[model samples]
Target: RGFVVFHAKFAENYRLYSRSHFVKGIELMILLIVYEIFGQPYRSPVAYILITVSMWFMVGTWLFAPFLFNPSGFEWQKIVDDWTDWNKWISNRGGIGVPPEKSWESWWEEEQEHLRYSG
Candidate 1:
């Protein structure tokens, strides 16, 4: 279970970081091209400022994407609250506390049943 949780978190972080970095890399390439073409001689401060501002905006948007684009329309705070509640419930009565007599299949079925009625 610990291994699975670690891998799941790692995969999710990898996916998010890779996607954002790929986009930033493309943006950097475009900026480099622009700098080479027009700003090479002048080394315009305006161009530098634009690039900096745009990069910051991109970072901000990526950081806030989960909150901005949540399909469920829940606020970030509400989502955090719900996640903590679920974690507490699971720790107290679900996977972490499964009885020795219960097989994995039965434990899973019990979880599903709990979800069906609770949710």
Candidate 2:
């Protein structure tokens, strides 16, 4: 039973991750096409703007892709707000974001809690 549950969860996560990467790859391709078209010397202002917006969209999608298919409802506004705050603070401080150790500890705790309740 435990193995079946783990396999199912793993499959779900793998599917989500694959889907996210596939979308990101498509975004990247679009960005590259836009760049190739408008990223040359003596480009018009409008072309530059288009390229910039395309790049931003690609990056935003890459950053937030994982949360798009989250089982817990998509909190787009909250995620954007949090990211904005973190970006502003990081720009001011010129420091790194969440430490890996701390992040790993929290993730471990969450996994253990989930298992405890799930089983």
Candidate 3:
């Protein structure tokens, strides 16, 4: 159960890490996976297990250290509200159709109007 909570928190922190460092995070995970898979065959089981566990612990540390240290003040509700307001402003001012409800014709017309006015 404790591992479960740790895993959940790790997952969230991993998500944050991925969002913040998209390409690098994906590359790191891929390389780690490749190393584990390919390197396992050459090494003794004990060595392999120890190394992989250590690697994952390091990955976990990388994920959670920033999470614990840097509470980036990410307010989800405020972000959503700001996005909604921006969407409304853009739609009202003719950027495109509103976010949730959209149509091809309306989108095309709005884009056309935008192009006409901007140029």
On TM-score, the candidate that comes out on top is: 3
**Residue 32 lDDT in candidate 3:** 77
Clashing pairs in 2: none
Off by over 4 Å in 1: 1-48, 72-77, 83-119
The local lDDT score (0 to 100) that residue 117 gets in candidate 2 is 72
Residue 87 displacement in candidate 2 (angstroms): 23
TM-score of each candidate structure, all chains considered together: 0.29, 0.29, 0.34
| Candidate 3 per-residue lDDT over residues 1-119, each given as its tens digit | 35332222322333345445544545666777888787748788788667678666666665546545544324565446545654554455333434322323444464356667774
Can you write out model 1's per-residue Cα lDDT over 71-93, one digit (the tens) per residue?
A: 44365665666455444434544
Error of 2 at 113 (Å): 34
For model 2 the local lDDT of residue 71 reads 44
lDDT of 2 by residue, 21-55 (tens): 65576667687767767677688877776757767
Off by over 4 Å in 2: 1-15, 19-23, 26-38, 44-46, 51-55, 69-119
Worst 10 residues of 3 by lDDT: 4-13
